[model samples]
Structures are given as C-alpha cells and as structure tokens.
Target: MELKKEFTDLEKSAVKLTVTVSQKDVAAAYAETLGTYVKQAQIPGFRKGHVPANILERKFGEGIKADTVSDIIDKALNEIFENDAEKANRPLPYAEPVMEKMPELDVAKDLSFSLTYDVYPKVDVKNFSGITIKEPQVTIGDKEIDEELKAVQERNAVVIDKKDDEKVEKDNIVTINYAELDENGNEIAGTKREDFVFTAGTDGTFYRIDDDVIGMKKGETKTITKTYAKDDKNESLAGTTKKISVTVTAIKIRNLPALDDELAQDVSEKYKTLDDLKKDIVKNMESAKARRIVEIKNNDLLSQLVEKNPFDIPSSMLNAELENRWYSMAQQFQTTPEQLEKMFSSAKQTKADILKEWAGASEKMLKSRIIVDNLIRARNISVTPEDVETRYKEIADRGGMSVDEVKKHYEDAKAKEYLIDDTKEQKLYDELYKEVKTVKGDAMSFADLFKGESN
Candidate 1:
C-alpha cells in the first residue's frame, strides 16, 4: 500500500487525485494476481490448478494487467481516504470518482493513475447577521371573520334537488357537462369535463360559465362563446374568446344555515354561542397569521441570506438533485419516469432537455440547502430527546391523533431521524428569528396576504 498521492484543484469544487504506487508493491500485486489466475485456470491441455504461469500469461496477460491496475487504484484510494485527517477533501456521496484514463501498467516501474471527482464546497457565510427583514402587517377583523364564517356556513348548508325540468338560477347548484370547441366546432381534447357541479353567479366554475349557465334547463345544451379579459387570472383563458358546449344535467338549490348559536353548535361541539364561535375564529386566525408570517419571514430573509452567501455546488450534487426532482414530477403526473420520458419524446424532446431547463432552480435549491446546513453546523444546533417528544405531541395535537399513534407513525429509524432533523431545523428557525430584526411591510388583508399560497 506504499504510495505517493497528490491533489490538484479543479473548478466547481472538483479535485483530481493523482496516485503513484512504488515498483515493489506493483510487482508484488501483479505477481499475486497472476498466481491466483494460474491456480484457477483449467486450460484444455492442462489439469485443473496445474496450468503453467507462462501458458496462463500467454492466454490472459492483458486481463491480469487490467485487474492488477484496478486493484491497485482501489487499494490506494481506500488507504488515502480512510486515513485522511481533513474531512473536506472527501468526495461527495453522489460523486463517484472518474478515472482520468486507464493507467499504463508496468511492473518494473511505479504504477501511476489519476481520478477526478467533486467534493463539498467550503462556505463562509457573510452578512447573515444583524440583517433587517420585513413582515406584512395584517389584521383579522370582523370582515375576515365574516368571510370565514360564510365559508363555514356554506359547508354546513343543506342541498335540495330540484325537479328534472327546473331551470338553473342564481345561487342554485348546477351540474353540467362542458367542453371547449375548436374553430372547426370539434371538441378539443383535454378540455372536456362531466358532472361539474358549482353554484351559479358565485365565480365557482374554472371557466367562469356561471352567467352563461343561468336560465338553461335540465337536458338543455347550448354553444356559448365567452370573452375573457386580457388580465384574466386564469392564464389559459386570458385574452382569448372560446366556444364551450354546455349541457345542463341536474340542478339543485343550497339552503345555508343561519349565522346563529344553533349553527355554531352544529359546526363544533365546543361552541355554545355564535359570539363564542367568532372569538374562537379570531384566535384561530391569529394563530394562522403567526404561522403565515413565519413563512413570509423565511421568504424575505432566507432568500437574502442565499444571495449574500455564494458558493459553488458540485456538478454531481446538482445532477442528483435534478434527477430527484424529475422523478418527483413524474410521480406527480402518476406516471413512471420511463413513460414520462416517452411523453416528452413524442414532443420531440428528451429527458435531458427537461433536466437542463430545471438546472438553475435546482442549483439554487442545493445552494440554499448547503448554506442553511453550514449555518446550522456553525451554530452547533441540536435536538434533544425531550425536544423530539414535544414535537411528537405537537404533531399529535395538530393531527387529532394520540401521542402513541404519532410515536408509532415515526417508529421507523428513518422516520425518527427525519423527525429529529425537522425539530433541529425548527430550532434553527427560532434562533434565526431571534437574531434578525423585523420591520413592518405593506398592510394587506388576510386574503391578500395568503393570495399566492395554498389555504
């Protein structure tokens, strides 16, 4: 295992490791390899375990040399990495060392070879402390409470089916089969829907066909043309006029519960009065506001943190991330990655093209992840068993599950590890909140505050 090793720096956090094993070790290794092949050989003219070295070499010299060289390289790398004091020079897990070239083996001389691979980047976070971030100032008042209560009332509303001949009217539930039409009046593919139920005159339909559906009777079909504004929120329909064939199949009326003590009692067992329900709603909204503000804070500050700290991510890491995302997207479509690739192929594109398009976003994701990890390490943040127990209880309370159930759910080692890591990350966020200063941003309503986010 006697060898000389040298490292050469490369771009994108890459390193080239050049290794040289001495002539004595090479001779010994080659001899040992050839001896094993000679004993194992069963040449047609020779008995098993009795093949002559000269004959075996004549038949398998190239193969012996290749094996000897590969074995030497593996031994050298294992020796170097296992005993190395500096941890940062270790290759990234996803970065397999690629041999620069197969070395020319010579037993009489030293065996020399080289490998190039990526290592984790060294990061020095700057301007991350004492920074100012803005948080939106939002108030959850009677208007917000009323809006939420209206949704609650609708959820508890009673639905009465109308007669088959009844016409669609405002505030009545309508079920229709709809399809968009091309210029030739043919139904366009991927735009057909059936049994789409929505309340009329409430902007409930995705295509905004509420007004068009009014006055249409059951079993009635009509070709309706609707013009969408240039700045329409629905991107596909914006700035376009499309003809849709709508067939009314069913109609019904919704009778919403009145906002009173009875409705409050029906909504949940804890509330005895409508005012008590409103107070509970305010408390819940306040809790939601605090949680949403944390998200906004992260969007405001962590983005700045990522920008302030710049580091190169190894190409191997980036590629692995991109591949993970590709599979994730394929899973979202409920298709296998191979099938997804075929779909892209039909469009004259390859999986590589899609991966290339996602490289920038993936790189940012990796970079931010590395920065936060570095910060977490530097701060020496950790999660204790008590912290994990508290987190489990919190999850159980939120999910309406028992503490034992939550524990059982996270019983697997990987799940338990994830929970620990999650708790540590939350702790990191807590520390970050304490470290940074928050200023009031623009005042917005609850709806506006959560506009781009999922409810």
Candidate 2:
C-alpha cells in the first residue's frame, strides 16, 4: 500500500491512497472477514444456513464486491491517517473526504481512492500585555433610585375610565374606542380596538395619540391620522398610516403615594422608614452602577484587544453565533420570524437579513470568547467542585428547584459546555481586572446611560 498527502489550504488536506490487491486477500475471501455474510450465509439450498460460500458469491457477487471495496477503502484510509498524523498537524476526522476521482483497476491492477478533509486550526496565544480599552464610568444616583421607584409605582398603578365631564391631562389615563382605516377607507382588520389606554405626555401607548387628545374632555369623539413605526411591538398595526376615529370614553388619573415611610413599606418590608429604604436603595444603586461601569469597560477592553490581535475567524462558527443571537432576539420580543418580518416589512429586514448584518458582531463576539478561553487555559484556571455546586444550587434556588434537579437538567454535553464556558468567562474577568488599567470618569446616572439610547 502507498499513500500520498497534499495541502489544499491552511486547514485542509487531500490524501490519495493506492493499494495492490494481494493474492492472500483474494484467496482468504476477505469479504467474509468484513462480516458482510455473517447473518446471510447458507450451506445448502434445503435450509437458509446450508448455502455454500461460492454459491453465495456467485448469486450476490456484485453486491458482495461493492461491500468488499468499501471495506478496503475504509481500512486503507485509516492506515493513511495514522501514518501521517503529525504531518497533518491539528487533526481529527474533520469532514467526509471528497473523492475527486477513483483509480481504475482490473483483476490484475492496483486499486486507489482519494480522500479530503479539513482539520481544526492551530491557535497561538500572544501579545497579552498591550491590550487596552476605555471603560465607561457609570454612577447610580438619587435621581436613578427615584426613577426606578417611580417605575415600580407605575407598574402597580391602576387605570380606570374617566368621568363624563373630566378633562384629559398629561399622565392622565385615557381609554377610548378606536378604529383605523387604510388609504382606501376600508376598515383594516386588527387596526380596531374597543379598549385602548394612553397617558398624555408619556409616550403614547399603542398607536401614537395626538396632542389634541390630551386636552379633550370625556364623552367627546375625534378622528385622528398618524403613522406607526415599522418596528412597533403591536404586529397588526405596525408600519401603517391610518385614520382612526376615537371616542373619549373616560380618563382615570394616577395619584402616586407620597414618597415617605409608606412608600418604603410598599417596596419591601425590610425598611421601617423612607430614610432606611433610601439608604439601602442608594447602596444597591451604587453596586448596580459599579457593575454597569465594569460591564462597559469590559466590552471596550475586549474590543480593543480583538482589534489589536485580529485573525481569520471560522465562518461556520460565526454563522452559528449569528443564528443564536437572532433566535435570542426573537424569543425576547415574543414573536415568530414570519411575524417580525411582516411587522418590519418596510425596513426589508427579515430575520435572515438581520442575522446577515449581525455576522460581523457575531465574529467579534466569538473572537472575544476565544481570547478569554485562551487566557483561562494559559492561567490554568481551576473551578472548584464546591464552586460548581454552590453556583448550581444558587441557580436552582432562583428557578424554584432543587440542586439535584438542576444537575439532572444539565445531563447533556451542551449544558456542561455552557457551564464551563461561564466559569471561564468569570475567571477571565477577574484576571482582566488585575491586568487592565481603569480610569475614573464623572459618574452618570443609569437613566442618563439608557435614556437617549432607548428612544
């Protein structure tokens, strides 16, 4: 047997193997050794197992010969791989080798087959000292705490229809019967609602309500026209400009409880007074702010690191990450791919289009992960059994399940891989804190961080 190897790409190789059929191979009837006839052999025609080997071959010669050829090719390929493991470098059964052409053979000639595959790329870790980036400074302030508390109150606030003579004001709850028609004046399905709530001056809920509705009194009716964004959460009304006739049914305004001990008790029983709550809130707020600052810094630092040490990323992995991100977004928005595409039709962004655009981000994300993984391995990061157990228990507790149940849920290899990756990421962050320089900047409230970004 003779084998030849060729390099087709950085991680791809092709092997051509030629084997001369020996006299012993044919004499021993190697097809029998390959277990093809174990369950089908017969010594005679009287009983199934009574048929003779020569008779079996003569009757099924073509089929048996085909199986014999496959066996020979497989065995020869294994030999070729084992002989050239080191020469191939990073190695595994990468992919099914594409046979460009097969060698022609007769009873007296050698048989040959060509196989091709791709191996894992070899990764080299280097230049760890120069990676640098800017970290955004975030500070949770009294204003942020107040804003969050207000949001909590709003979540708990009740809405009711306004009285017949009541006038609508900013933040005053307004309920109405509304129907929207397209340019044809045909009533659009799903564009009509008998009950919809909008608070004036706050972002108009559902379709944007005009300022004219804000100052209107109850029992009044008006027809308004407006355009809704293509990305609106309401699927049926998005991306459509329609004339809507709305009748002011009633307005129920929210009156927040005074920010005092009562408010403190409403949030949690741990606080006896508003001052006590404020102290705890401020502490929690500061911790949250610090975490946000760390996260921003982390992203900036990693981005810089990736920029400095850029290399070719595996296209397959990048595409996988993009799909994963798209699925995540779809799940968060509580909509299907088709529904989202319909809602955002004007934008021409189907899920596939969005994912294609995100490919670069996905590549960068995976590059960052690769760097973090290298760092973990280089530092010989160790995750204690206790640490895993404690973390598992914490997650289980949050999920309202026992640790054993959580362990059972992670029985698959993929789950274990995720847990290990999480552990490594955490360790990398800790290591980064020690190596990276952090500059303090003027602290900004969480609201300031997200306000312009959200709108």
Candidate 3:
C-alpha cells in the first residue's frame, strides 16, 4: 500500500492511496475457499468430499475471485486507519471511493485500486493561560423568590373569559380575524385567514404580538399592519406586509392561585406547606444557577478556543449538522416540516428553505464541534464505564423505566449510537473544564435567571 496527500485549493487536503494485491496473495486467499468447498463437495460422478481440485476450480473459480477482491478492499481500509491512529484529524471520508476503473487480475500479476479522501485543515490550539471570563455571579435573593412564586402561581393558574364590558390587556388571549398581503395590497398567495387565537406574550404562535395585539380591548375591531421576516418559516407569507382586522370576540386572563398549603400541594406532593415549597424551589434554583454559570464560562472559553485555533470544516459535516438541527426543531414542535406547513399554513417552511436558512450557522456549529472533539482526544480525556452506567441509570429513572429494561430496549444499533454520542459530549465538557482557569463564582439562584428579564 502506498499513501500520499496532495494540497488543494481552499486549505483542503486530498489523500490518495494505491493498494496492490499480488496474484500470489489472491491465490492463497482463494485456496482456503476451495479447500472448504472441496470438503463439502458432491459431484455427479463422485462421492461427497471427493471432488477433484481442478474440477472445483472450474466450478467455483469466479466465486473465489469475487470473495478475494472483497477481502482485499476491506483489509486495505482496515490497515489505513490502523496504520496511523491520527487519521481522526482527517476530514471524515465524505464519499466511498469508486472502483470500476481499478486494475483487473491477470494470471501472474497484481490487481490494484485507488482510494481518495478529503482532510480538514489542521488546527493548532494554544494560548489558554491568559484567558479570563466573567462567571455571572448567581444569587438567590428574596425578590427573585417572590418572582419565582409568581411564575409558579401563573403556571398553576386557570384562565377564565373576561366580562363583555371588561377591558383587554397584556397577558390576555384575544380572538381575531387576520390576513396577510403583498406590497401591491393584493392578498398574499398563502396569507388569507378567518379567526385565529393569539396570546399577548412573545410566544412563537403570535408573531410580533407586542406591537399588534397588546393594549387592545374586547369587542374592539382594528386593522394592524406589519412586515414579516423573509426567513420566517412561512414560505408564502415571508417578506410581505399584510392587514389584520381583528374583532376581539372574547378576552381571557390568568387567575393565579393563592400561595398557601393548597398551592404547595398543587406544585408537588413532596411539599406540605408554602414555606416548604419555597425551600424546594430555592434549592432547585441554586443548582440551576451553578449549572448556568458553568455553561456560560464553558461557552466563552470554547468561543475563544475556536478563534485561537482556526481550521476549515468539511461541507459534508456541515450538511449533517443542518439536517440534525432541522430534525431537532421538528421534534421540539412535535411535527414534521410538511405537517407543520399544513397545520400552520401561514408559518410553514419548505425543506429547501430550511436548508438555506440553517446552512451558515450549521457550518459554524460543525466546525466548533470538530474543535471540541479534537481537543478532548488530544488531551487524552476518557469517559469510564462507570460514568456511562451512571448516566444510563439516571436517564432510565427520568424516563420512568428500570435500568435493566432501558438497557434491553436500547440493545439495538441506533440506541447505542445515541448513548455513545451523549457520553462523548459529557466527557468532552469535563475535559474542557479541566483545561480552563476556573474561579468559583458566588452561589447563584435559578429563580433570578429564570425570571423574564423585563419582568
């Protein structure tokens, strides 16, 4: 096997490997196959296991050649990675090599095939000594607790329709009639609509609700106009201005429950009193705050790391990330893209549109992930069996299943892949933390961070 790398445009590297399998080696490989077949042979004129070598050759000769060829190709690839463990730095093989033009075997010569692959640009990571990041001191103050209690109350609140004479305000849900249009005042191809429900908050369902829906009262009818973003998931209505005439049919407001023993029971059975619930909330907030600080510091260090160690990412990897992102978003919304567009006819997306929108960010994310993986490997960080088992158990418990049952359910290939990927990310985070200069921040509370910034 002869291997060489050639530099190409755009900081890419192409590796060309030539593999030669001599006739002698091929014959030896075929001989073992012939021997096995001969032992089980049953020819027309001979007893089982008594077939002649020449006869067997004439019968199974082509089959032996095919098997030999497959074995050689598999062996070549295995040797390529085994020859140098550092092949991980190479751009992962984007496409399998084409071998239709490979050399054919002759009576006494060798057969050969050429293999090609692309390599990602090299990244030299350094200069970690002077790095400093502010760890957003987290504190659980009384005000934060009060705000959290308010949120909890809201979550447990029941919504009731307001009286016809009552005025509508923020946090109230309003029913309206809306339609989207083009610049020419002609109704946009996909924007015509009748009645729609919209909340007054920044929830994704109500696009630009703050500017259009808030401050309006029940029984009031009004026309509101706004520009929709070009990349808005709605393919037809995107980049268009539309008129919405809303006749508020009814208004509904949240009615928070009192913070007492009943509220405590509503939140969780583990707590018996309001104070007990508050203590539990505080404990959860503290843990969450600590985690947020760690996450923020980690992201800061990684962003700096990417800048210090620059390298080109493979287009294939970037494409994969884009697809993963789309799938993730789809899962979050609980529907496929096609279904989403059909359901939210005004705010659905085409596959091509989604790809175009996510391509740039996906590419950057792919490059960053590559850097994180390489750094973790270079530092010799490892996730142990115990770590994996502990995580698996925790996941099983959260999923409401026994660990043994979870293991059995994930005994297949796809589940193992998910487990390994999850474990690798966890292990990589630990490796990164060790490399950075960490200063313990103040004990922060989750309530402070969880509250809406403006609120």
Q: What is the TM-score (0 to 1) of candidate 2?
A: 0.63
Q: What do the candidate models score in CA lDDT, each in turn?
A: 0.84, 0.63, 0.66
Q: List the residue pairs that clash in candidate 1.
A: none
User: Between which residue pairs do clashes occur in model 2?
Assistant: 42-49, 42-50, 42-51, 43-49, 43-50, 43-51, 44-50, 44-51, 162-250, 162-251
Best by TM-score: 1
Q: What is the C-alpha RMSD of each candidate to the true structure, in Å?
A: 5.1, 7.4, 7.6
Candidate 3: residue 446 Cα off by (Å): 6.4
Task: Kindly list the per-residue Cα lDDT of model 1 for residues 36-86, writing each as its tens digit.
Answer: 998899889889889999988898999999999988888888888887574
lDDT per residue as tens, model 3, 290-405: 66666677667777777776677655556666777767776655567455444344444466676887787666666667777676666666667787688779777555468998
- Model 1 bad stretches (over 4 Å): 1-4, 22-28, 75-87, 93-96, 153-280, 333-361, 393-405, 433-435
Tens digits of per-residue lDDT, candidate 2, 93-194, equal 424455666544233434555555444333455655765555556656567777877775776566566677778888887778776555676655534566
How much is the lDDT of residue 276 in candidate 2?
84
lDDT of 2: 0.63
* Clashes, model 2: 10
Best by lDDT: 1
Over 4 Å off, model 2: 1-122, 159-255, 346-352, 385-420, 450-455
- Per-prediction TM-score, please? 0.73, 0.63, 0.65
Top-down lDDT ranking: 1, 3, 2
